[model samples]
Target: MTELMLKYFRKKQQEVQTEKIYDTQCPFCSMQCKMQLIEQSIVSRKQYKTVGIDNPTTHGRVCVKGLNAYQHAFHKERLKYPMLKVNGEFVRITWEQALEQIKDQFTRIQDEDGLNALAVYGSASITNEEAYLLGKFARVALKTKYIDYNGRLCMSAAASAASQTFGMDRGLTNSLAEIPYTRCIILAGTNIAECQPTIMPYFEKAKENGAFIIAIDPRETSTTKLADLHLKVKPGTDAALANGLLKVIIEENYMDEQFIQERANGFDEVAEYVRSIKLAEIEEITGVSINQIRKAAITFGKEETGMIFTARGVEQQTDGAAAVRNFLNILVATGKLGKLHCGFGAITGQGNGQGAREHGQKADQLPGYRLIENEAHRTQIANVWGIHPEDLPGKGVSAYEMMEKIDEREITGMFLMCSNPVVSNPNAHFVKNALKKLKFLVAVDLFISETAKLADLILPTSSYLEDAGTMTNVEGRVTLREASCPCPGEVKHDWQIIVEIARVMGKEKYFSFSSAEEIFNELRLASRGGIADYYGITYERLRKEGGILWPCPELDHKGTTRLFETSFAHPDGKAVMVVVPNKSVVPKEEVCSEYPLYLTTGRVMSHYLTGVQTRRSPALAARNIESYMEIHPTTARKYQIVDHSLVKIESRRGSIIVRSKYTEEIRPDTIFVPFHWADSQNVNNLVGEELDPVCRMPGFKLSAVKVKPVNDVNI
Candidate 1:
């Protein structure tokens, strides 16, 4: 046979001999794209191709990161076997020995100190069952109430405000899938283009439907490019812009007076308060024109139906809670409550941030989205736990505050599960130091992460592909199923690991669940008739429907796609219109000559919230390996730094050496940096712990820094 013919025949044979279908979701971000693995060759692992399924929530589109999901599963850094750090290096150890040692040390600590001295920190990536088990293990087994998740950094402020005003801290009232029905969509502080790319279609469709779209951000990003009006406001001036819009809404009489009088409260006070905020005065503070605020407000308030969405931008500031309240004021005054397409929504960052908060991992919240401090909520959760709610600690410090108090010996022991805070946490230098001061540190990770390197006992855990669990997306849709692959090496599922540790600590009674299904059933019962109101959903119903929205707590109830369609969740069935005044919370009052540039840091589309999983992917690394500082071309010229040249960014907190990418995408006096790189060069190292007063979220953005050319070409 001819050589070409022989080659063609061999290729055909290879395809036929390759492995069959393997099912998995894109591991990069929360918009989990279900993919099908197609065999390409005999020896090589199957490559994934996105299934042409009928699911249109994301419109059958995937981002650059989603297309490369296999990279994380097959990465060289994956924890293949259990290892124990002996002396200064990690050494391979059997699962039996590692578990035995962890049990011994943790038990000894529990006997020596008290339960409050030991804390267990879980993650938003894990399923609700895993989170509940971890918290139960900490409280019942180790007898500690200091259990929290990393969601505190992602959505605590918005959750706090929503709970206060709406009587429920559940997910967004309107699903992103329902965005098409709106006449106007206002996004504040969220860069949906770069993060949460799956929902980009919703914003695009809103634009296509002639819905007025406004983006309020300090930086002009990809999402801002498509906005009908882009307000490049100053840092911490979100409330100013929001109030300025509300001022225009009141002055112009664009609100639905009938709805306000019938279905809302505090409108008179909100109007009186908004009258005090002059549009012209706020323009000076927000760096936006008075006309722009009026234009956005007119379009939004006058629309038949509108939805206002805010993300970490408004929720991560010093007055993040007020910023959220400001948006609520606009909606309530405009009479946009209790409707299908009109309300306020928060776009959460983490995959399971909503679920984790809903189920009982937060310091101030209990199961069923109830408050731990509220007597009624506490009583509900206490009933489920078969203990007095008063017996539980009232509330603990937030994630950031907890780290701050670590050195005071307030937090003696820590069990970090499925999270790498040393790399992702703001002010890495401070967090690393705090972890060092802990008397006992345990980390459960799929890799030997930087955070795990500091652990006294590390638990090797299975990845999402090797376990069965559910993850709630940003839109409050719950995706269910288990992995199709065998559990790799000696790694165990997070729940199984928690169960083992709980048994070792003599808390075996609370960890009696045989599978995630059994635990999820109990969670459904706890949430019955509660704020999240998952009384209609059941494990059996979930399997039959493939997916189901919450409030489907029972067998016969239909799920709700839009919230507050007829009645508001607040008292008197009316939404409250808060009188939000222009507030500024930027703490760095003055910028010295040494640090003249204002720095703003965030995530990119190609990487996850943190680069713990994405950084290990060669394809992702090839896209953007080293960190690069984004500065205006004029600023780069002033410093005599060539494009792509190495530079050192220094702040009062710390310093990092990174390359400079001179671009017009940044503001003149501001610089933008991606907060994904994990190393000394990480941009987060330069961010201080000075945080949002209401939310306790560190100021990852809005910091002063100085950038200078680095002569060393290798840097």
Candidate 2:
């Protein structure tokens, strides 16, 4: 495998010398750093070399993952054809045989077990057009209500909080260009320096202009290193810290009373709740000092224009929705929103996280970010598809819940696309077992991932470079991804595969998209009047303008860059401030004598999610060969463990052996592990499946665990 990868990289390097580089965006993270892919046709084999492109987001900058992303297309493990599992062994099969088998099995499952028995698990990495088609195929073809995507695990809580507060969910309310102009910026739970490196420069510019940057996290991350103040709060205590800051802001008379009285609702109720949180209690609940909270409150409140940003760290908690709401409440009370250089939002992680949610890959959504249960939304979308409104199914369970139901036969068959839940899901060991209970599983991906390994049939799909589609970035910018090379071997584009299956299932009228452009054209009409309206964004416009922000309602209208400037999306045009009482950070499975440490999982700069694509790149693998636990020096000393010593981190759920790196960056009572590796090194094995009630986002950040020397354990 290594030799094959090396040979491919060598050939790519040699071919790049004589090939044309096509402009495109990175497939790694939501920063969507624009880059150019040089298509090289060496002899008869095709390869690519990635180069940075000058764009508004990156300005010709690319990270390690972006620079090496081209290698994923030519990896040794690239699936070249369709295969079916026969007697525990996969055998190469024709596309017709695979499609027929899927049609027969899916038909039988629905006929016998009903439509609810079949499920579709989509992806956040696919194009908006592809995601829209998958949702349509699930409802109109297979007729399943159990449809969701991996984004549920990452951005659902943020989405829920945004919608509940502002009546619409788009990760950011302002453009990335405004970051440097804000007087203050508070980042909760996100490590932009490592996770989204291109964004760091904007924060740096803010600091250069005397802006106070506060980083609220338990660990001292690359982002924290740039902070004016680091509020090292305890894990899962984000709500308390936010409420505490609000308390100080209110007591000190720093709030914008005029703005609050004019543009916000429920301020009195939320302010009363904030007034109830005592500073002493806040210091105890969150691990930060009362003085630190006061400093953060004063810096944030004094600023005329500021922004509050969050990511998975706060959004992956059991109280994630509450945390996000409380965070937004601070902004609303301070009158920091609806103005230039001021806003509150999340830094989306996946490549197309914003677009995927808008286009209906989520369980509870339809095209144009409409609710699946809404009769009007159903009627509107059904009319566009030339189907009856009654034919549309109701809202389904979320991704994690869908997985749990698989063991109960509620969801007997699943079509998994562009995701590897076995390595990415919380409580991964349990997820793997639940996957085994499926009657039939169809995996559509470029490689045979750990999740794909359990599939009844696997279909090889083209990589991002071989597909033409649109992807919305973190700032809600709609960008184009152009096809620069032909797919390898018999591999097909994901949209083509979905259309073929839909045709085979006798839904040809609805799935007659000959090209991505045709599907995108339909998407424009479906999203015409919705919050994420894309009617004004065409492929030609995207090409000419580099990118365009959403809510562009007409061809002549320029896209909206700053949302909620004069009015919000709510009917009353007022931001809603929800008041949620403080909750404990400890999980239901509390820390005890046997398992006394708080375990948190996060990402590293070198590798992307689950290590599916990045792991294939030799450059990335060489930077971080395997996963290791980051233990505080005090914790390491107490446990009698040295740096680089192998240790067994065990939880009630499962255990894994990893090398320990002692550092002062993490709290003494907490351990941090990167959840990129599979098998024993997979940290999700130690994570609990406690989900946020409102959004169904799992608490991937906090778990109870115990660590000891590997030699001391009887393995």
Candidate 3:
């Protein structure tokens, strides 16, 4: 039997040479750092090692996580087959059994509870082709109105703001290669040094070339240390700081009147609001003083070429979208957009965040970033699907809103793919409970993720290295991710799995996709004339070029690597300056007598979101084994908490225990913790569910809490 198994393995791998390499990109972050996956054989075992590939995004540099991506793809606990919870134990089940069960459960739920009762939640990590199929699966196969992805938790705020402000949303307005020549950069609530270290070299080059750098964050993160100016704004106060900066820009005559007159609109209203903002109030809201704000504003306003990059730190708040818009105001007011090295972009964190949102997977959007609510956009997609416009469901709720619906028993069944909301969502305890309420859940994942543990049936799926599809990077570069290996066991590509399920549900014709390429071709047609035009982005072209940026509307077009060079995507051919009212930003759960400290959550070096893949990575796991709260030394003294001491941090919503790591880099009034761990260590457990009015993003970045030493708690 052993010899037969060895022969089977040998036959499967085709007796390949150990040194064989497949060029691919890292499967983790939006940077999509190019790397070569090398096949390694030890005795009867085969694994992979990655070497950096010279590319526009990474410039031949890969982060520690990128280097270890292959390890997690073949992690020890990788799901090998479909599993069903029988008698409270996950038992191995054949694919037929799993599909039959899902079909029966889903059909019954839809019949009894209506189509809206079944929800489809997906991930940003999956390829763009996979996202588009899942969206189709939900709409055509199930005809459900509830469909959303994990990106709503992370990127929706920035997407909302950018769309409303610029009339189109691209992760970066200017490609990353242009940053080194930029004269100034504002790192707004993004820790690129830790979260996206590979791309930091561009900023470093710009710094060497005399570019002024400004970092705005509550904690003095690695990103802040490198900045020429650190605006340590109080937690949840990003909007106030941004509004005040715009105020200073307008008041000091730093805004370009000529540019505003020629290329933008609605600045007069924004100017009206900016003038009403008082400097004293701004200082009181953001911790930075008036003098610092003026200096930073002046440096940015006076710069010939500059860019502003924002992240979750500013986008995961109760006012996340409004805050992001306020930040965009500075760039627009200065007439800095659409020019080389002058624009605004949200720093996407997920591997395919840029493409995933352009996608049909989003609740309110169709492929090509077309809005579902619009009759024309709906008709366009409906025609591509060969379905009547009436057959397509209307817009659904946001990600967290879907959780609420599940809790209310409105959404009784869900097809969860690739996302681990139990660890990544706000009020995670609530999410877990709400997920538990689902009568049926079919999860497709490479690993038994935190969310998968609760699934009624879990399907093993191909890992990133074992799948071939295209993903859009943070710079809006849509690049291909080639398969390095075949699925080791019964595992299948995610698109294949979803198609199989669709066939079982009696919708095979609509989803009869033979390959990712075929699906991508349909996506191109679906997105042809929409804002995020992909008509010309063919697989043939992707392989030949480094990467092609979107709005490649024609076969002869080389793609718009530099966005807004000619005009914004709006119908009027001009950007809009959204008038963000100057108001004091308030935390959803305010810091008060009981919870006397501000608690913020973020990523740490060596770890990725939810730690599903990164934690399974032996090296990355060892680098940051146990979660710890970063407490200011002064705050630590007040709480009698010593370094490495376990502390109980309680909020109005939930409580978590983590060892404290004293640091002076954080504000004394605020404590920081990384949200890469699960269970009690999951900081999302303490985060509130207050939705941003514009973006509907939960307040994941800011909360109120109090900490006590575990010993004191025991007493």
> TM-score for model 3?
0.96
What tens-digit string does per-residue lDDT give for candidate 2 at 1-715? 6999999998767765567776667888898888888776776766667888887777888998998888887888899999999999999999999999998999998888998999999999999999999999999988888999999999998999999998998888989899999999999999988899988899999999989999998899999999999998888788888889999999999999998999999999988887877999999988899999999999899989999999999999888988998899889899888789999869999999999999889999999999898999999999998999999988998898898999787899999998999988888899999999999999999888999999999999988778889999899999998877678889999999999999999999889989999999999999889888999899999898888988899998889888998887899999999787778343445678989998988999999899999999888999999999999999998898889989999998899989999889998989999999999999998888878889988889889899998888876
Cα deviation at 302, candidate 1, in Å, is 1.9
lDDT of every model, 2 decimals:
0.76, 0.90, 0.89
Looking at candidate 1, the ten consecutive residues that score lowest on lDDT are: 48-57
Clashing pairs in 1: 534-553, 535-553, 535-554, 536-552, 536-553, 536-554, 537-552, 537-553
Alpha-carbon runs more than 4 Å astray in model 3: 1-17, 42-47, 584-587
TM-score of each: 0.94, 0.96, 0.96
Candidate 3 lDDT by residue in tens digits, 299-392: 9988888899999999988888988988888888898888877888799999999999997889999999999999999899999999999999
Query: What lDDT tens digits, residue by residue, belong to model 1 across residues 1-715?
Result: 9999999998877665555566555554556555554435455544545452334346456777766666777677788777777886788888778778777777777677766778878788888788766665665577676777788878877887776567665566866666877898899998989888877887788789888889988778999998988888776678888888988988998988988888777889988887876778898878889888888999997888998888887887667777788888788777776687777778878877877778777776667777677898777766776766667666766776777667677778888898888777778888888999987787898777888999877777877667777766666767664577777677788898888877766667767878888888777777777777666776676667655666565678767667777767787887766666576454533357988888888788778766877887778878888888888999888888889988988888888888888778667778888888777678878877776666677666667888888883335
* Lowest-sum lDDT 10-residue window in model 2: 581-590
lDDT of 3: 0.89
Query: Which pairs in model 3 have colliding backbones?
Result: none
